[model samples]
Target: MEIYGCSVTDYSDRYEERLNLYKDKFEDRDESIFLEREMINFKDFHNVLVSIFNCFIKNNDYHKLINDPQFINHLNHLQNNYNDVFKELFQIGPPLLDANKNVSNPDDIKNEDNRGYIFYFDFTKEKVDNLIVSTKRILKYLNNKKLRLQKPRTPESEEEYKGSITTKETKPPKPSKIPAKWHALAYLIELKSKGLKPPINTEGAFIKLELEAIGRIKTGLKGQGFYREVSKHYKDLDKPEILNKSFGKDWKDTILKLFNSNIVLKEYIDKHY
Candidate 1:
């Protein structure tokens, strides 16, 4: 399954709590955090669909699939035919119902590279069952293959789909996203530069915020005392009215509204420094 594009979120217990935490927090938000989790869940849900379709495709008989060149040829030959049945789905690089597909826009992928992709789709149970039934019908339609491998798929035939989707709608355009992983850090830097507080806390709070910003890509930050001199910093901005006026919506909407924004750590000298 790993070789076949299973993801860390699919297998590991390590990130489960964090992932589920985000799921619960962002459940009602329009933000990508919740949506991406749902999409990944949808992708994983298709494992059963893949298994059933693949079983029939590989072997007409329920219990067995063998290394016969005939079935292999039948699968390869129906490339053009399958696309017809899955007109909308096969058109993009979604991990939708297509057993063989890749990301339409690799850069738009939201997860880390080590984790598999999160593919957004309208994954209602009815839709999936519809696709399963359609695909199965096609497979059954193709089951009476009177001819065997006339010739293996040409290099050109395989290459054709590699470039694009089989449908008329263009691949979904790349969505706008926070430009970098340090989005939390960059936003925090901006907040502190503006002389913000609530931003004010103990040194530990500051360190925790800084870590949230630059988690994997560690860099020196202004050490604790730089920002946590809570006495020096004016703390009135922690009020909801001011927060709503500050960022407009997102920050104030959540319960962690106060310090959920990033924190400060002293800018320590490092090799990069």
Candidate 2:
């Protein structure tokens, strides 16, 4: 069954076949129920991962499946299927917070009784924390690798002639524009990593990236709404009056603070402001 818009077919036909075989041979006698049962529960990001992992384990090729094309396909499909889910998680209110009202450690947040919003995903806990931490690690790793691969190549300089030809000064490379939502999420991740809770109701929350602090702001009713809100804020940030009201007159310096963490956002601010 489809879960978060992903089904067994999305992983791979072969994997689905194998899953069916296992369902027939091992646990469920009802093929329809086994095939159609929901695999992901939005309250717990770990559900899909665990279900997939179980599938591999059932096939007795769990170790060999690493880096396998089909396995990667499954992960990619999972990522694609859960894209909206990720967006929602990043945008919503009642962020996970520790007893000190700071961002809670992923490990500490694993217990079902935790007072954080994430606890609603799976009441059982059950590796949910690991899923969150591992997902961040995997995303960061993939994002960095993608950045490296997409970087433009510089041409080799011609050998300088002795006092015959002058070489022109090379201009500094410009930063590419990353999605504003991406930069915002990255900043949020940075705050979480540092044990800071992102606030859910403050304007100019983006400025917190500069101060290495987390400010409050309600993202919005949905991921798209939140993105639109932040995008508009980012667009209007250049105004003197808006800056004066949201941040202090020293907003220029405050804005520069974001540059320290998110290079692409800094570049965006520089190019726009």
What local distance difference test score does each model get?
A: 0.35, 0.40
For model 1, how does the per-residue alpha-carbon lDDT over 1-273 read when each residue is reduced to its tens digit?
111112333233333454466446433222233223333333433434564355445554311322344534433433333433243333343333333543444455456631432222223223445655543443332232211212233356666768664544434334223222223433343445544433224552543332222222222232233233322223433354644454455542231222343333223101111
Residue 136 C-alpha lDDT in model 2:
45
Q: What TM-score should be assigned to candidate 1? A: 0.23
Candidate 2 structure lDDT: 0.40
lDDT of 1 at 216: 20
Q: TM-scores across all candidates? A: 0.23, 0.22
How many backbone clashes does every candidate have? 9, 14
For candidate 1, which ten residues in a row score worst on lDDT? 264-273
Which candidate wins on TM-score? 1
lDDT of 2 by residue, 76-184 (tens): 5565766664334323443321135443334444445344433433332234344544544434433444355345555455554445543455343343243334345
